[model samples]
Target: MLVHLLYASRAAHTMSGQDLVAILKQSREHNAGAGLTGLLCHSDGVFMQLLEGGRDAVNARYQRIASDPRHKDVILLSYAEIAEREFAGWTMGQVNLHRLNPGLVLKYSATSHLDPYSMSGRAMLSLFRELVSSGAIECS
Candidate 1:
């Protein structure tokens, strides 16, 4: 089964553009090496990432992320089995809010939307797609 996990964490220090570039550089290498796929969106001091892979691969990635010192106050927002992968095109993509239009957030987080715990693959995809096109998330 394809596993999907969404998580958030607080940045330990100010995340400058250079800092993000360095992290994305490392994440791309790691995700490619592990044969994983994901999209990460950052906003309002929170890092929200969606990872998809085999159970073991996803779990292993989570383990490593949880121990990383750069990120603290880790929180698992949601996890579940999905019929389809939402971020299949990404090896480890990142979207920072600095360049993003906050309107996307307002749209996705609309009251008519599914609750975070009950969000569907399509909903998640829409969210990621918005971030992807917003130019807010760039590759290092």
Candidate 2:
């Protein structure tokens, strides 16, 4: 069975541009080899990620992420068996929320900021879909 997991974590410390780049690079390669696909959004020192794949693979990956030193306050937002992958084409898509339009954020999140902590997992997923559809965010 396939599973989808959404989680939010605070950065252990402020991440520089190079830090984010390195994370994405590693994630893409690792996810592709593991048959996983997902979207990662970063903003205001928080990381929100959606991972979809075989149940074991997704759970294992989430466990690793939860224990990573780079992440703090890891919170599972949602996890469940899903009939389809929402980001199947993306090995590890990335979005820098700071660059996104405020209007789009407000439209879906009722705020001009990317505050995933205040939003439900379903809401955050919808926001990401809208951002992708409107060309406001692109997967790497």
Candidate 3:
């Protein structure tokens, strides 16, 4: 069965552009090899990721991410056995949430800023879909 997992985590330290690039490169390569697809959004040291793949693959990957030393406060926001993937265009697409229109963010989150901890999984997912529709995602 296929599954989709949504998660949020805080960076253990400040992140730089180079660091983000490295993470994306590694994620894209590994995910492609593992048959996973997803989108990742990072801003202000926070990371929000959506992974869709075979159940075991998704779960195993999530476990690894939750335990990875580079991440802190890793929270599994949502998970489900899905009939199909919501995001399949990129091995791991990237979104810069800070560049999003404030009004767009305000619709699903408080204060025009995304605090995944304060938002419902459904809301966060909705925002992610909107980002895709708005051409806000960057692919490498």
The candidate maximizing TM-score is: 3
Query: How many residue-pair clashes does candidate 1 contain?
Result: 1
For each candidate in the order shown, give its overall lDDT on alpha carbons. 0.72, 0.86, 0.92
Clashing residue pairs, candidate 2?
Answer: none
Give the TM-scores of the predictions, in the order they appear: 0.75, 0.92, 0.97
RMSD of 3: 0.9
Better of 1 and 3 by TM-score: 3
- In candidate 1, position 34 carries an lDDT of 75
Better structure of 1 and 2 per lDDT: 2
- lDDT for each residue of candidate 2 in 24-114, tens digit (9 for 90 to 100): 9999999999999988888878998989999999999999999999999999988989999978988988875556888877876767777
Stretches of candidate 3 exceeding 4 Å from the true structure? none
Worst 10 residues of 3 by lDDT: 96-105
- Angstrom error of the Cα, residue 13, model 1: value is 1.6
Compared with the true structure, what per-residue lDDT tens digits does model 3 show for residues 79-133? 8899998888899999966568889889998778778988888888999999999
